[model samples]
Target: MITTKLYNRYQTVIPSEIRKKISVDPDSIVEWTINEKGKVELEFRKRLTEKDIIGLIKQELPYNSVEIKKRSGRGLDWE
Candidate 1:
């Protein structure tokens, strides 16, 4: 298990290997919560925005252009 000490009020470096295993980035906003036993933990990151989703899709499927599925009952409305 990795042991980390909290120092200075606003500066802490989560170990690089841990960050890589968790796929966390520098600008991520972390959420901390305490369990019933008073042990604090960081929750999973937030949901991705539409742009984030698109970016991930492109990263995974670089050769493919995504096709949008329009809502049902939409009748030829192109503006």
Candidate 2:
């Protein structure tokens, strides 16, 4: 079992090996919650902002003429 000590500020390092295995980076946001068995659980999640949406639009994607026609109010059979 991995062991760690609480520092004077009550902060503890999650151990480099464990962090590497879990793919967690420094200063990454983590959520700690308790499960039904009172076991601690950690989850990594990133919040999306307006900038993220713009970046998604800038990213490469498949073309969709059907969607374009529908969006333009054109009569296009989409069967």
Candidate 3:
């Protein structure tokens, strides 16, 4: 296992090897959690914005447009 020393203000630098493996960058978000066994788990999350989602949607949709499905009936139909 890799070990690191806790510096002032309880901050420690994540090792380069770990960072490379996880593809972490300056803007990456890190999540920390403690389980019932009192073991700490770290999760990496990539930050995304509405603009990013719109771009992804454009790529996924046909002709770069959003198609809404419509029903014939006016009200909700329950069988």
Number of the top TM-score candidate = 3
Candidate 3 minimal-lDDT segment of 10 residues: 64-73
Error of 2 at 75 (Å): 44
lDDT of 2 at 29: 83
Query: Candidate 1 vs candidate 3: which has greater TM-score?
Result: 3
TM for every model, in the order presented, reads 0.52, 0.55, 0.62
Query: What TM-score should be assigned to candidate 1?
Result: 0.52
lDDT of 1 by residue, 3-79 (tens): 67878796677888888888888667789999999999886575554345544543443332233223222443433
Q: Cα lDDT of all candidates, in order?
A: 0.63, 0.70, 0.70
Candidate 2 backbone collisions, by pair: none
Q: How many backbone clashes does candidate 2 have?
A: 0
TM-score of 3: 0.62
Candidate 1 lowest-lDDT run of ten: 64-73
Stronger candidate by lDDT (1 vs 2): 2
* Regions of candidate 2 where Cα sits further than 4 Å from its true position: 46-53, 57-79
**Per-residue C-alpha lDDT of model 2 across residues 27-65, encoded as one tens digit per residue:** 578899999999999897665443344434543666464
